[model samples]
Target: MALSWALASGAQSVTSGHRTLFVTLSIVVTLVTLGITLWSRHSTHTTGQFYTGGREFFAMQNGLALSGDFMSAASVLGITGSMSLYGFDGFLYAIGFLVGWVVFLLLIAEPMRNTGRFTLADTLSLRLRERPIRTAAAVANLTTVIFYLLAQMVGAGALVAVLLGSSGGGTKDVVILILGALMIVYVVLGGMKGITWVAITKTVLLLVVAAIATVLLLDQFGWNLSHLLGTAASKSPQGKAFLSPGLEYGKTVASRVDFVSQAMALGFGLAGLPHCLMRVYTVPTARTARKSVGWAIGMMGGFYLMTLVLGFGAAALVGPATIKASDPTGNTALILLAQAVGGRPGSLGSTVMLGIFACVAFISILAVVASLTLAASSSLAHDLYAAVIRKGKATELEELWAARYASIGIGAVAVLLSLLAQKMNVAFLVSLAIAMAGSSLVPTMLFALFWRRFTTKGAVWATYGGLIVSVTLVLFSPVVSGSPDAMFPGVDFQWFPLGNPGIVSIPLGFLFGWIGTLLSDERPDPAKFAEQEVRALTGAGAY
Candidate 1:
């Protein structure tokens, strides 16, 4: 009876029955994914296939995969958890994320698809000198990918540990390692084809589960949205504050500025992310890429809308105290909500619901980590190794093998770092990753795509300089020290006031690009700009 009550309040650990079911479903999904990988070997033999899924996917398939890649543990779990605890402030994330996609659809997607060969570096190198620009872009790609990967790994390991009721430090490490190895297998063996299938499959499952849970939640409130919000506000300890913006970040001028900076990062950073940009290259043509982005925005917008309900549902049903008790970050709110809605603990319905959520969460982690690993490995092989190191002389076979090895290496490093970083907050890392991307990649991409006078020196300076400033600021920021959410709580050396560096670093990136170009003696190359514009607009020589 206590277990049954705990389900409604989300105050206790998962039941043993649910854990068993969760483990079983996890195994089934893992085996199925591995089978898909094996089957994909036929298409992955060529470099184009391995890197871009042979550029064969149509608009809808690529759109679903794009949605899958964008909707990570952070988007589903982190944002919902924020909503459950912070209410109106949390919905700001949904708005910011959606706005970022508008940037991609209007500016980045079509041209990126038309110009790039395999990676983001390929596009940057089109107008600039090959070696320096490629190397700089590769560094920017790896920095963003590794940070994003570490956050995902930590969240996955923690979520799996909670589902299985395992608390030992070694068990957490082992979970991270296995998850890393599983993702590496998806990238190394299956490449883009296998990864795309997994993304599309998992994203649909995640959306379905969310939709079902939302419907059940609506049923409890007589299908009235206002009633749900009212119940959530009454149940929350913050009361009316839970329905307003001040609960999370509106307390002081400084806090508001930091919030704005974070919002900027979320709004502009999606266009700059290497993994998201790489998705554009998978479509058959520029027109298909634009259509795919439109589809992805629709799906993602619907999902975020559903999260508002799920967030309120968790607040009204499970309460914030229990959510924090399960995980301080409130990432387990949806899992608890799933069990509560299904039935009382130990019931057949509860067991089935718990099993479904376990599989969903596992697949969410797998899809995101696989994309990140692929992105990082592509930078190493296609950009750094083949272009910079081998002077564009390496054979396709050689580059492909290099990519596989790079995936394993990157996974291993991420697993170890994630294990060490278990105490850090996943949400903070996600925001940091976005801010880094906005600071480094956004400026360079805009200048290269639109400005004729943008030189190699300017591009390199923006990439490397923006990266250094962002990383250095993060190292000294409050997220790393001096507060309750600090990664190293005992340390107090925080100097940067803002939690995110986008507001400051992004402008610096653009300024560095402009200043570098002005100082460089390299003559303006209008012809190169014309050629790139022609290719980007007309889709010539894209394949």
Candidate 2:
């Protein structure tokens, strides 16, 4: 009922003229992205350029692209909306995300840059059994990337719901299909070069729009944060409690544990995200990868700080009641805030503000969808098809065709799944994907890089074991079937109390890897371990 009401409310809030403006902006942005893709296509004939942009991007260029890839619509629109409704608890997402980027830089990026050729599987298959190791890595990669794709598409669906404004289901489905088609073209025609530039373009626009919104918001309050906070608190339903941590996650012991688990997921998950790992190989040297991450951190940090102000600004200007009435999940908080900040409903400023923010959000979603699809298709071609099926005999032309077709297939699957699961909570799907990554990929990569005695069995175990446990736990948890906000609230099949399984699944992934290593009869390759260590640390003999 809340979901239906939220959708209907959101539909009613959008005016017909504003809806036309959104479509106009989307078309303009799509044409621009297509032009960028065409310009980059000539350079992407080889697999290296298709996958890593030929390792030629400077730190600043790649940094902005990294920021583009990392800062999804989920983080910008969703997190600001989250903070608008949940206050301090929602602020935790920014902290966890920033900290996770730092963790990836310090622990994951340099080693990956120094080691992998194409995919995350390349890094794991360094010394392990190529077939089984690549297979397992591909499975984990597809699992995480697909879930992320679904999350982004769901956000796209919500945007459609808002734009259509009470239109019939057929119209909304067409919009989603158009979106899917655009995403397929981005990956198939442009590849990494196009995707990188698309990301760079959208990231700049998103940051600029966000910064303007933040400055205008602050100006309304005389540049005094205290006044903003005071107004937000006074207008919020929870009042003073809205300024504290307990409003969202502190009501019960189980909820508190789930909050901690979620924090764990975000903190470690970014280190293991397949798409982020792929970004490392786009830089020439490990030092460049590190420097690029540094640049990303600085830019993303500025963006998150702006979100804090915007989140509060939304609450102060739009109020909790209007926000919840429009969208129960708070996804529309930014939109409503934009409308409010732009002056009267029929004014030109209002229309322009809505158009700019909506356009950037639309572009951001498409870019993220394309990136995820590319990651999955690349893994399918390079890891499973070339390595496992062809035994590494496939030519570059065959591999490229495989990747292009795979992108179309994966994009279709994601679009279909998004339509099917349109009623599911977008936040739940994203959290589950990250938790799975934290549990499965993190342990496998950590051991592969540092453990001298780690074996092929251990890597396989860690990857499959972590993924299986995370999904199983969530299936039986409140997030899936039991709670009011669950995907299937009509039933009560939940056995686990916590919403997130990260705290348990992550440790077990490591333990299972260790145990699997000890139980295997296979001997550890000390020579390979030594080479890996040298390459990971000193960039000597690195690909």
lDDT of 1 by residue, 1-543 (tens): 000001112324578888889889888988988899889878898779989999999999999999999888677777787788889787888888889999999999988888898988888888798999998998899989988888888877777776777665676788898999899999989999999999998889989988998888899889999998998899888888888878878988888998888778888788888889889989899999999999999999999999999998989888888787776667777787787778886788877887787778788889989999999999999999988899989999999999999999999999889989887766567777887898889999989999999999999899888888888888888878998777778889999988888888888989999999898888867888999999999999887
Instruction: Tell me the TM-score of each prediction against the true structure.
Output: 0.96, 0.97
Model 2 global lDDT (CA atoms, 0 to 1)? 0.86
- lDDT to native, each model: 0.85, 0.86
Q: Looking at model 1, which ten-residue stretch has the lowest summed lDDT?
A: 1-10
Candidate 1 C-alpha RMSD relative to the actual structure:
3.4
TM-score of 2: 0.97
Error of 1 at 444 (Å): 0.7
Model 2 residue 253 CA deviation (Å) reads 1.1
Name the candidate that leads on TM-score.
2
Q: Model 2 over residues 109-160: C-alpha lDDT tens digits? A: 8998888899888888888889998999899999999888888877677676
